[model samples]
Target: MSISVVLLGEQESMVRQIESYQGELIVTRVCSEIAEAVAACLTAGAEVLLIADAQQVPLMEQVDELLSQGTAVVYLLDGSAAISPMPEVLQLPADIAMSDLEQRITATVRSLKLPEGSPERDDRETADLEPRDKGRIVSFWSAPGSPGRSTVALNFAVEAAAAGRSVVLLDADTYAASISIQLGLMDESASVAQICRIMDSGSADISRLNAACSLVQVGDTTIRVGTGIPRSSRWPEVRPSALRRATLAFKDHYDLVVLDVAPHIALDEQLSFDTQAPQRNAVTVEMLGCSDDIFMVVQSDSVGIPRALRAIDELEESHADLQPKIIFNRVSVSRSGRSPKRRLIEAWDRFGPMHDVVGFLPNDSAVCSASVLAGSPLLEIAPRSSLRMEIRSLAGIKSSNLPKKRVSRRFSKSA
Candidate 1:
């Protein structure tokens, strides 16, 4: 058998993956509380004490005590680059595939010398981790420039939270990361980069994920907000596997996983004859891959409309699996001369390839500016404004028409 695991804190998804995997790992005890986790070591005979949250970083001493007793410590961290106080111990990403994470954790522990008087050790065959459910991931993206992707994502998240569902608004945009600025958050602390680090760290659980997510109020709705890359240049740090796991983990923690993704699909390393190298724009595509529903944000002006339609056509061709709902933002009814919706639909049906348009959002610069200035959602700044009404209408449509994932029972026993 592999190492016995004494899991602590909340991350049912991670726990389920570990236990369900066909490995030598036997989970002797799984504790929901941190105290239980620290104390479980003494009686459970577990060789590995796995803490799911980086937020419990203060528990280093207790972890060390376990280590001194020969219990291997594996902390799943949120993407923060904070070095572990004990370097010899294993640190794994929370959102990593259970099979991959298990192999790494077990192999690493095997390589480490068993401490004096320690006994929790097994030398059996091992493998990696996979994934499971949490909730439906809704990702919003746009073409080259700003199509209010973040704004729309923020609105949807706030509206969903206001409707009594837990919502997480994540800014994974590789281009001009702007959620911190849009929401007026001065603390540039938790970004996707940090979360990626945690997922890569192999110890990330709900607590560490939440530690990386800042709670912000949008209107009366309070929701979790995951910041984006501090700078566009830091895009290389985000990996597709890490992002998938992080999103899956976030789904477990929240009712809705709303991600604002990057704009392009460009590779980061193409020359490495390996051909499997990471790409910078994988941020957008991978999010699309995981998304249950995708909203392709687009402007409604003449130039913007044609560009967006072409982009949508291209997306349909490139990502056949993704049925992205094209959202035409900023349409001026009067300027269009005739019925804007009718004209657009007619044009879309004839010229566009996919021709699937969600609907049109009215253009209102005054209201948009007001919301930005107040650092509030459109509902708070100008609830009756056309833009807010359209977005709110879309939110209602989502609640009514979209299928939401029911929470999985797999984590109940372990969580």
Candidate 2:
């Protein structure tokens, strides 16, 4: 009996090579869209998929539905593609028997289903639900134009770590990459893009995770850090497939995973069957989708409050499950706007139901600047800073008083 396979990822040379290897076996359809690949698998009963783009591996769940009917999938992992294999990963030559490849893929999919104690199952791509032990992912997502999202994210990771939670901080801000410079991590190449690259190849493990993450020590507490894209234009590197896998792997290891994300939420909708890359905003949306908690940081001013409100409205429209806690940052100390917090609350109340003010941080530029210059968090560099204390209180907030999450305005407020 011959096995059926579908080819994707637009790597025509690789696809042709695969076709040659299969000989008389069935090639159901050469598809570009993953959805089409799924349709091909179901309609034609393709037993395997030769995926060229490791970035497309997030389609695993959709593909897994096909697996129950004996379909197995694996990324071809050719070195010629955007993802380069590690020196240790030996490549399968073109002459390898098609039967040998089928056996390998069958084992890979089977291993993905067994318990973690099984050596073969360990570090494999298990997409949907991990055990209850999987950690929480908290993201600091704000509107663009420097609203202190990174600062809040870094501080939150530090606080979480200090509270004895194993934490990993991911700088995922694709637009204005700053986590590396802010932490004085001089190694430009040790960013999260490397992790994305490895995961894209469908082979991410503890060894790779350790290589991608940097450790920062605050007294006895340690926070693992994954730097963001060093350049904004290089958006293609952190594709959704890579992003989803890396986050799932980290969640498996740490008690808390923190992401400092970009602000935009646009999805690239184009007229091409091979448009696998979601918009640049796709990365941020992916992070939000995976995160267990979100802190929507906003500046406490007329311009900032209105902008933040608009952002929430937009996010709510697109994502129905967005119950983000609104954190008002840089509360004024000059007493110019008497009862600014009160006024901010009153303004939001009129718009619609709102999440209570999570907490407030003072405008302490000197302290934050000093900590950044020293390549340390305020907890270590300026423990006495008013900003640090406020953040501490913010982190220690009881969940019951977390302010009831309510629906936003019936309609969006004008920009």
Candidate 3:
């Protein structure tokens, strides 16, 4: 299939440069009015929209509206141009020059292309033949330096399982393979390595995968855990396609699939064996791209607040559509020397208004100590802890907010 695109700008030279591309190109010239340009692009069936430097600020809103319409956009910026303070509002990848713009447009188009006999389409065709009762996927992620992502993910999975939901906790963080070590399940007998090997050979059956999974029962909840690779470099072997397929298979067998992805952006590699992959500073974007909702967890401190603000900007740049729910972990009323609510408000005021303060987890030494000793979730080890209650309340809010009819319909269709 040929690539279809629409170029929006007043610069005739830039439009001509895009017209020079090798593949099938359809270019529409839009002058000053941003709305008309966007409407023209949409009417032309342009899958990718390229905005040149000549476009005005109002053009950004049109870009946003196009994105909402499912059109991938690439912004062309001058190499020497001074970046605006609010660059996050322009939620498209910025290209420094004509070549960069060309590359991004091509990449976006290539990624969106449907492969021959696409798996998703094929799966939908056999929807009646396969089990459809596959449950929801709740993924957990946090900023780099230990915002308690794993702990929260593990406990949330445990709590959901305890609520009579069949949950499978997947340790998708390839950089640090700590879930096994944390749960004392790191043994030669069962690991994700074997599963990866099976998948690498293109012979990973459901039975083989089930055989590799280690089941850990806590109280009334049964959890199947998937371990990560020992080293971060091995992540390339664990392709996102494979991870997605594995999750789909798990969804068929479980009621909920809780994923713990690494606190990094997903990147592509030409060779499957690259040791040091190119890291895109857009991790938040990558996570939001794949997630239904995002829970941004931050420690209530000076350093944490600053980092959260930076992370929010990066996330907004990648996914302006995602409104992340802010979770204040380790919030201490006395530590702030004033009201905790007041401090939180101050932080929000300084950072941005795109975040919502959903809940706060109190700093509790007992909960931390119990988690380390028991190698279990805080909810299991310290059920009465204030931290546990806060986490439970957050989980309850998520559960209550979920549409009952939608869940039932999804499950019924799967069944």
Candidate 4:
């Protein structure tokens, strides 16, 4: 079968060289710019896009999007510098013999075209299979206040681990990462950042995650903690693509992957300036996009409610299909007025989006404060606290230690 192709390059020499090639791959269009080339590929219904110079592409995110649309990309390299291998992208030296390049292209196209159940396709599928018991990634986010997002996430992970599920807690907040300090592990190195760096270098594996993480034990359970960046100024280190890869690696190795991320999810930086520039909140945004379940925590106050409503709007704009469970933290009569939970529910139904409030963590100032001061999860610091019990219920963790209610032995027989 003849493969449709679009050729792109920054330099005239490289474009001229690729265009002069004589092969079965038909070059339908030649574009000097990234956007133009991408548009041409879609409009012309091309199957393959051959980029002579990868450096010319400003936004790697755009390349990812194109690849998602099922267009095969071939990056022709001048061999000037080494680059990490990107998934599904073919890279070859531009100086290779045209005949050799043609053969490689034909082979790659043919492999991609192989019908399902064919021996080669089946073999590849068998090799690519992930473990049947893959883990779930759940993320907790808030509206940029001390809404107890980190606290909730930490306790939830502990509860999950205690319930016999292998859990990994990831601190993915780029602006302020407190999981390390919260867990009382004051190491300067950030495991999440280190894992992202390793992923970007194309060397990420389960061993890398285990090596980068710190093990924290609560009761009889141990949780692998992926600590966040020590300094907020180093947000650039956790790129979106790398973070996604790291999260996938975590999911493959654990039964539950819990992420605590920053409140910011706006793409303002990408829209206002050069799209290729690093995004400050990209880590949080990427986690939101990838997580199977998202818990949106809001403080039960006038200010917190308004802020959370705005956050919901933002989520609607960015992730239309996301049905995040709304959780109210620090529910109290003083802040939310009389009958706090009921009143808060009424207000949310009237003012907020369609998403219903999932659960409320009641105000336990004494217990929460003590846990913070002690640098421990509530499950360990105050397992019987109301806040802890609520969190346990929310996380679906059942404890046999709960006091049973006395049943009235005298039952009035209606019969």
Top lDDT hit? 4
- Tens digits of per-residue lDDT, candidate 3, 174-266, equal 666577666656453334555555554444366767666777766544677776666655554554434554665666677777777665553
Per-model lDDT = 0.70, 0.69, 0.60, 0.78
Better of 1 and 3 by TM-score: 1
Q: Compute each candidate's TM-score over C-alphas.
A: 0.63, 0.68, 0.60, 0.74
Two-way lDDT contest, 1 vs 2, winner:
1
lDDT of 1 at 216: 75
**How many clashing residue pairs are found in candidate 3?**
2
lDDT of 4 by residue, 193-251 (tens): 78876775555457766878888777766888888988877878888777887787778
lDDT per residue as tens, model 1, 136-243: 799988877777788888888877876778887888887777777777775555467777777766555777777777777554447788888776667777776577
- lDDT, candidate 2, equals 0.69
**Model 2 error, position 389 (Å):** 1.6
State in Å the error of residue 24, model 1.
18
Model 2 residue-pair collision total: 0
At residue 243, candidate 2 shows an lDDT of 72
Best prediction by TM-score = 4
lDDT (Cα, tens digit) per residue for candidate 2, span 85-159? 321122343345567765655555456457534555544543223456788899898876677889888988887
